[model samples]
Target: MANPGYCVKNNIYETWKNWEAVNLEGMKEIGYALSGCNQRFLNFVVFEGEKVSVNNFYFIAHPYNLELPVLCRVFRIQPYNPEMELGRTGPLAGKKRRKADYGKKLEYIIGFAEILGYYDKGGKWRQMEVAPRPWDSVYEPTEDSLRQFLLCQQFAQNALVVEIGKVRGTSIPVYLDLNAIARTHTFVAGMTRSGKSSFIINLVRASSNLKPRPRFVIFDRRGEYGALMKYGAEVIPYTEFMPAITNPDVIVGKLELKRTEKEVVLSAVRMLIEEGESINREALYKKAEKVAETKASDKTRTKTLENIKWALDNKGAFIDREKKPLDIISQIRKTPITVVDYSVDTDIEAQQRTATHIINHIKDYAMAQRSKGDFACIIAVEEAQYLAPEKGAEVKESSAQGEAKAAFIEAISQAGGYNVGLIVMTQRPAYVAKSVISQCNSVVCFRLKSGNDQEAIMNYTEYGSERLAEYLPGLADHEAMLWGMAIPTPFPLIAEMDVKEYPQKAAAFAKQAWERMEEKVEG
Candidate 1:
């Protein structure tokens, strides 16, 4: 509720008549008597009109603020000059002019403020439809006046609320809507050691405990999520879940088979199905070799065979005779979190192939099961650059594997409406696919050192601008600027990850564990 009586004892800024932005002179000394408040660059300033009319002027509120979040960013500053000053014509002439105009610079500080929003009759802060009437008494919003801009009904409910950070001034905990993540997708960006992994872990822990817990499938590139296994996150080796070639699309799209080899794969799968045999690497390889002998040229045959052998060697035992194809969505349904660790997968391409396959399957499952209500999940892909590489780069989109990965990312981004959230985290934002980043509705940005990466964030994500970009490089570890639909308002926050919550690095208990080990060894 808006307390009109929550007044400030001191707010003495008065507007000048020549405040029209159209006229250069009119903008000069736009507001005068700028005194009293300890105003900063981004503070809320309310202009009080003579009569209290509905159109009198109210600004929209930032969802984060508990009261009114109408804030103006102080962009530029200049001297307040009411009239053109000609150098004192003469000492006597200066005295005759007036004491106020004689031998004095302007007393008022002139600065331009971008009107953010104002409070409406319902006490809800709304965005300003038009510029406020100029020459009114401009007063800095009192702290109490600013508190009424709490999150609206759209955010306060149906949100997976967790303490992400604290509001700038008060100890009030700031929360994010995890539901928004599935609805619009999220981007977690930072440089190395900028707490990107920590943030992910924190998020996983939070989401794991939600009322109707959302499934989390993390693509653990560097095995960072091994610590999160205690949170019911099953850490499966990449080899254990090498995608079976159940779908012909997997062979060409994910495995990156050549145009010629695609036919060999199709023939192989057909042969296996005819024999009522499960799709396995050995069967597929044998069929490819058989096809190579007749249809493929000697050069093409050798390369095709070599590619098949390389995949089998690198991706290890994808064909389980009895076991069904590894369904990531099924695992997610049973467990809150599933981490597919690629630490053992030395070949980068092999890792990409596996990830591409998993993402595709999950997206398909989520979209198909959208009406089921129980099929909600979030896939947090670490080292997302590899999965969704920028076009024409080292991992060009033209490449078979790259296209598959890009396609999967595109699908997940597009399938947000189907309750499938893609949380992409990367150290190098510049390399991540532009389409993927652009699709993200929420952005949790840690420190970014590279100008290219910073520029990418500004270009792709929401509320990203020069002002926000300026803070990226200087953010402390664990601190980030949280923006987008997930949070009520975009603000800098220190993500809290209690040591107990991340028991993976239980350093305090290491000594006790060592003692137990010594006792067991003696026994």
Candidate 2:
């Protein structure tokens, strides 16, 4: 007996003819369901003259059932030729068969798809309880039908939605739930130059345009996001916006002060606060010298004074002596987008301290805002691996860096209650803290070349199967797989990111600078 999975030749021809007669204009009869159908997977064989590609969406319809059609995505395709396979191993093992013998008569295409469930009457995707029977007709849905099934129309005009890109090959706009992203946090990871940064820039622009816009505090490590100033963003240098010291012990911990030195520094900070003096580098150094003179021996005082002076001189990127500290809370409240440009500061330890300090302040402020009504803000951290490195990784991290990582992880875990969101973007997910990535409810992944990095992403998302990881290294630029609460469905979808034009490229700026230097030489 013939296999039950395949339809008879005549039956397939008749099915195609009947489908055409029905005049379903855009819907095309492409194939028939085959034997391996199940609740989670569908196997089908394509008819002659029809084509299907990986990642394409198709619908399977039952002959007698009137339920909504099941939507599935093609992930694998192979050529099927049972006769040719047998002929090669049978009598024709040594003899070469003429190409004209079989022609295309025995050739067929097989497709393996993952069932993406079907949209219910209310337009929500639900799991499939039953699989389509063998020989059932498979259809390539029209663009309109696919869009409607994906619920693209509902979010098109919604103000709270932010359009990141389109469904990979279609014009259907893919939107993310802004509220969900802000409250639950998001993780965006990819290799360098894989369009992760561009996606974030677009997100910032979209979020800024919304009414009662949530504040955006972007820690721009590479100084790239300054172009957002054209979109009404306030780009401030890191040195100008450092926060004042609130706790002496915290500062001492950040400085990694020695046992004897820690007391002198702590006493100095306390004296500065008590005497109503601004705790800048010079004032702190002066107060520390006085404390060392009063409590230490000559040998101890010399070492203590030298340590304090060195710390003030070298690790003072976030310290200010004369000028009043900028009110960061007021700045975040007033500006729609605040970019803290850290490109100029090369002190890694100071950067960590600054990040930790600012995060603590934001957390406190966010809590107060949430008490009144709906208030939201996003803290987008670029190059997050440096600030939130995994504990005891290859690179030895400082105590201050550990504090920064802790603060970020804490913020991510408790952000929903405070309405403060965290967007952690990194080129090296392997180096970043797993806790930070795991807490984020949404993820946008671009091409990742490292197996370790791919494995890191796999730990957090449900779609991170071995087969799915195989696709990560090959994803094109500007294309990303989006999943989790921010998206419309639980099944991940690849998006072609839509980024707005910004200022001149970095290369152009460098060329301009070289030309200026040449002119100076000529003069």
Candidate 3:
């Protein structure tokens, strides 16, 4: 039998056929045809992998015919045939193959006609050698790529929808999703107030609305994600999610934290909670010992220490109008888009430190996942420099914010691949670490006014083209240059996504704030 965990990618065509059959028979039966304008395929190629199993790929024809690939990962590669025609004899013959399927995170490699068939492994200059296919109606869809999709389907069942969108009534509908251009990661950046936040919201909205809703855990720093609740998303605040170690008993109880290279992850957990002014918390923690007396109520003792730690840290964080530190527990338990709103968090240094506290908390949780398994989490940090900056900047790690930035960057940059995907929005792309931004393959870019920001974006992408370079500066509000898993090639699109669940338009508050100021002036 075929393994279930492999993946295949396909692009959608706007000026081409409406639908294509799933298998070879189905594709022909449905009259699936290809157009030259929006032709599919990418000339880009990553690392060359050895073809170990013949059943390690597939042809996915998903519902609604959306443009995205399906991922099929082979865990137990049983004996199979090279031709993939099935009914073959080999060692451990007739045994079934199994795979770990990921239909949600599919990276469709689009064929850039500008860089088609260029395989010189040198510098960026090699990209220039690939010749662009003519914008004509004579191009044909590859029976080869489709046949490869069929061979891949022997290992995976992810629905791959091929799409190629093109301009109306003119140019060839090009084959956008190419085979050679392998899976590529993306990073998006723009100047401040350039609608980057709005672009992110719209992108996630598209991902969530897929045939089967995608489960994403967003680490919201600005509290702006409150609108994503309509998708039935589950949001967990960094504060209250710590039911694991609220007291000495829970820490000493059945749970075990994942270990890191630093070795002080456990100590950091103690400091965030019951440690208090007493330095002995680490000693107590190392021994996994309860209090000698064991007379104090666990709830009362835990609460008191928690309050003390809050009081000390509160001095460094923004206080509500009622003078309480910005607590994330209440909001985390409420929605999937857990908003750790640091918008009012004015003390740049202090806010960064608080984010650090959350980062340490995430580290502990991730460590716990060693035996616990993937919890499916994604952490997003808006205005990332405030939380995860470098060591020698004006904001020194000597301060709490500086300290937080350091830890947040460490946790995200190092731990992101292990059940953690970091999402950050910043105007000064220069300040954000190269290591952190480079990891993001899915990037949505709006208008960037600075040459430095533009230059940074160019360095982190594999889809750069002369036309795309020209279009970068021309992006308007609601118009974005989206890259990565969403679309094929670096195409400009008019995003028509709504403001999630906010429903009615948010009334402008400028008049109200201005009126209050005027009244004070008159008085």
Candidate 4:
């Protein structure tokens, strides 16, 4: 008996007469002769059963075995036409025709799904590595059939869900394995204003429901991530964190300072500790300056004191030196979020230095806490190039900044092992350190205009070739290409973003701030 899952199409094989001529490997070539149907590339096609049953329950009850119906997709298309015969003496008889014949036949060649496995009657997916038979009956997959065919067990019930982006065409909500993102690193690449920030905001919102609630440490370079801080993340500035730092070596090393100047600061702290002289907020700089005067030149001594004062003043007057010291690891483990805002510094290098310090501190802390078992945390770097640049780039490979950045580059290269994952988002993938981009386990890319940007993505991913790379320039707003180990196959997706899910755009706040002055005047 035929299964209700499939309709009987006795003459389906007849339409596949051209299959033998173009069938190479497992791809079947079918004629474009359907009266009302339109065939598109990448769309699913199901091979109908001639004397086979597709009902899952029917196969479960009976021991008789039959091959399951094949699911395939159109990969390529070609048109063939015969040239008209011309008189023997005609001048154009030997010339090739430039236009295609409208009446000529067109054929499409389809590649079978690279099936990893299939679900059994007992609800377990079994492994079967094979392709569809040649000249099998093929039909357009119905919506329900397509869902069942492409639907993976990972998307089924009880899995830790992270809403990635929606599948193109249908409203199917695509999900990411949150465990996978935490285990393997995720990289996001797009041009400026391509909705990368909004996509990330949506991802953070999705993560609110996870059990145990994984920790997140965000490096906000442009100060655009306040929406997350408002969502309960602890916002800390570089100078605010300075008060609690037991070792000033890590902080001073990255700040471009002369050797004598560094020793001056170091010696001051040493003298104060040895003599039991208590160093308070006001006396700290004075103690360090007194040490500089003893061995430093008059010119160098003055510069050292000025540099030390500038470091303290960098955070502006907002920071309270007497405020309780912040323990980042303990705070992250408790609140599970920490936002390092570099918005105070207008210079890019200053921001980079601060981020480098924070990342190094987090990496060391996470490694230390690993012995306690499963101490996983994620660090999201906004402008990743500064922290992890390729060799020969501007950031020196042997400098303190480079060494700090290397710690992260090394962690990501090891596939986020030791329970530390990295999410590096950049508008310029080409500028981002190649070491970081190459190690990404999964990549989410939005539309990029530059050829170099497209090429950078192609270099990192296996499925993105020059032909498909062309799609990067034409993707609709909010549309992106998601490829890598996280997905079963490379998919073109439309990101699901709800402004209500987080804060509105920064422009909205800027407008309100600008109009507030007028309100006071009117009042």
lDDT of 4 at 338: 79
Pairing residues by index, what is the TM-score of model 2?
Answer: 0.80
Global lDDT scores for all candidate models: 0.61, 0.75, 0.40, 0.55
Displacement of the residue 336 alpha carbon in candidate 1, Å: 1.0
> Candidate 2 vs candidate 4: which has greater TM-score?
2
Give per-model TM-scores: 0.65, 0.80, 0.49, 0.63
Which tens-of-lDDT digit does each residue in 396-455 have in candidate 1?
A: 443346555666666755679888888888999998888889999888888898999999
lDDT of 3 by residue, 1-523 (tens): 2211112232222111223332323221111112342222222211123222211222222212222222111112222224233542322242546321232123222222221211111211112222223331112223444333222211112432222222211132212111111122235466655566664554455444344322344445555665665656544443432212233222322122222211232343454455453323344333222331142355554543443344324431211112334334333334444545554435444355456666676656666775665443455566666565534444652345545656765775555444555666677766776665666665656666666666666775544433445455655554445555434333323232233333112344788879988999999
Q: Any runs in candidate 4 off by more than 4 Å, and if so which?
A: 1-140, 153-159, 229-239, 242-325, 347-350, 392-400, 462-464, 488-523
Better of 3 and 4 by TM-score: 4
> Candidate 4 lDDT, tens digit per residue, 1-523?
3321111111222322212211122323232122222211122222222121111100110112233433333322222223433442222443653433432333222222222233444434354443323333343444444444344333312234455555555555555655566667888888877777777666776566556576888777666666775567777775555333334454354344457767876776667667776544345677877887896888777887887777656732322235754566676778767777666665444455456555566667667776776577778887677777655554553244555566667768653666677888888888777778877778778879987777777887555555445456766666676766555333333344333343234565677977997888899
**Following a full C-alpha superposition, what root-mean-square deviation does model 3 have from the true structure?**
20.9
Q: Per-prediction count of colliding residue pairs?
A: 22, 0, 55, 0
Q: Residue 464 lDDT in model 4? A: 57
Q: Which stretches of candidate 3 lie over 4 Å from their true place?
A: 1-186, 204-223, 229-335, 370-372, 390-398, 464-468, 485-512, 519-523
Top candidate on lDDT is 2
Give the lDDT ranking, best first: 2, 1, 4, 3
**Candidate 1 global TM-score:** 0.65
